[model samples]
Target: MDPKIKSLPTMAFPQISGIAALGFAFLIVLGNVFLVPAGLPHAGAETGEVIAFFTTSKDIVGIASMLTPLAWVLATLFGAGAVSVLWQSDRDRGEAWSLVGFGGLILQNGAFAAVIAIRLALASTTAHDSTATTELWALHDALFMLNGTFLTLALIGLSISGLRAGLIRQWHGRLGLLAAALLFSSATLAPLIMDQAGPLGLLGLIGWLMWVVWVGTYGITLIRGGAVPIESQSHATSSKP
Candidate 1:
């Protein structure tokens, strides 16, 4: 490393944020496997199936729902760190992608929280009113639509930014592009067919899985990149005055 680069301030914020985000993702997967009962139906499932799932998994689901907000908040922090790192690479041009990526993440997390909130509220019903349950489930799916859209934009924006900045590898960028394409296609085409379990839907699911991997790698890249030139540049500017 150049002496100037080596002399730049080092920060662990991005690394810590990355680890936290990964931990939160792990927690979600674990919650689904152990806390939530298996064979649960989806938001677009039949009324009886939906009720059955809630009946079986309400308490555990509620617990997970309660914890999700915190998880997303940590994700948001990591996302911001991602933006910071990208900004350092190309200040003027990177700004647009960084802002879009940050906004997308915030919206995605907020929508996720809203979906959980709606579900949690429905779960509180002692008696499973079929009408109320069905409506809430519909709302949950709708929220997921919005969440999915934001997620697609987030990955696309971040991937492109990271690609241009050389912060992430080319293969990683391509993976993100593929994931984004799958999600966008699903978001637009699947609803037309009204097939939640159709090809597009499966694509979306695969995309989501890819998203987890993409984010994990993205966070790690950000962590490994470290905060140097940004801090150092600002310091140099301040000292000049």
Candidate 2:
């Protein structure tokens, strides 16, 4: 191995992955704060128009245009680390389960991509005035459950690995579990924002965004510091999930 490269087994890939994950987290937050609001309509007798306005905002446009692909790339990075850290080992009973959990991450994020595609489809079909657009959005709402499912599986897999392998500190493991719960709850409340303004709706977004941010940076400091548990782990953690 090249001396410099040999010093870091993964060739400092984790740092690059961290940067990408942070960028993706920022975009998701940006979409939630500015673009998501625009797509929804404000209160009053014109509530439907208000909901439609935010639902169809340029932000959602930007999401389908840019963020979906970005999410796929970022997810791949996380998946790398996860594959290495959680699923590659026979040390824990959860190894096979973590594989399944992170596998859900792939599927869940795919669902989000589906949502973005559905949004873009709705926008494109508007010019023709088709009933299919409405049907699609309803389907999109249902599909969003996948993202929450992804989070739940991600946290569960890691949390189980943490307990069994002693891979992560207790706090981070607990936080991972909590974040999963928040993410799942968000799916229920996301569509409610259309019915009326409510704290649960806003809190759900905030919680989920925070969840994304937290997960992105989790284990990063240890990974860079060359912590023993991380380095000596039996399998590779792809950082993808």
Candidate 3:
């Protein structure tokens, strides 16, 4: 490592925040996989079915639904942490991209929180109004469109900033780009092709997992006292493919 790199200021707060974000994201995945039903029906599910599901899975659903919003909130903080690190590094170079990424991430979290809140409301309610449930579920699905699009925006901006600012490795930047592409593809093509079934949402999920790993690895590097300095930015940018 360059001497200048070793002299740079440590970013311990953002590093810790990033690690926390990773932990929260893992909780979300675990909740989804083990707590929520795999074969749950979408919008237009009968009132009886909805009630039955809520009645049967209420405990786990309540816990998982609560975890969902908490995880998303952590995601928003993760975005902020990225912004903090990059912005502190070079105000002029990383500010715009970091802000853009942060904004997109906030929007994505809001969208996800909305969906989770709706699910929680549905699960908690004792009223068996099929039409109301259907309408809410439809709204939930519609809001889900924001998830992939905003996530793509966040990834693109962060990856570009990371590449240009030398905050992360070239391979990591490329991984972010790939994840963003997958999210964008899923957001655009899934709705058009999958419709109500929305099987293509899996693409977004996979991309999200890829993104988690990329960000988590970067966070771990930072926590391990990796070098990131202004003088080394150019050399870091040109290091590898």
How would you order the candidates by TM-score, starting with the best? 1, 3, 2
Q: Residue by residue across 1-241, what tens digits does model 1's lDDT show?
A: 7999999987677787777667656655665674435555654678898788778777777777767867787778878887766665545442477667778888888888788787777667779989988888877776776467888888888888777666678899999889888877766764552445544467667888888888888767766754434544454345553
lDDT tens readout by residue for model 3, 1-241: 9999999987577776677667766876777775545435444345576667766676777777767767776777777777777764445533477777888878887778888787788778886587787677667766665477888888888888767777788898899889999888877875563355456667777897887787677666555654456665555445535
lDDT of 1 at 230: 52
Cα-based lDDT for every prediction = 0.73, 0.58, 0.71
Per TM-score, the best of the predicted structures is 1
- Residue ranges of candidate 2 with Cα displaced over 4 Å: 1-10, 41-60, 88-94, 126-130, 185-203, 222-241
lDDT of 2 by residue, 101-151 (tens): 567667767778787786666555445333554456557655654367676
- Is 1 or 3 the stronger prediction by lDDT? 1
Task: Give the lowest summed-lDDT range of ten residues in model 1.
Answer: 190-199
Supply the global lDDT for candidate 2: 0.58
Backbone clashes, each candidate: 0, 28, 0
In angstroms, how far off is 20's CA in candidate 3? Answer: 2.1
Error of 3 at 79 (Å): 2.0
Stretches of model 1 off by over 4 angstroms after superposition: 1-11, 35-37, 193-196, 226-241
- What TM-score, computed on C-alpha atoms, does each candidate reach? 0.82, 0.70, 0.78
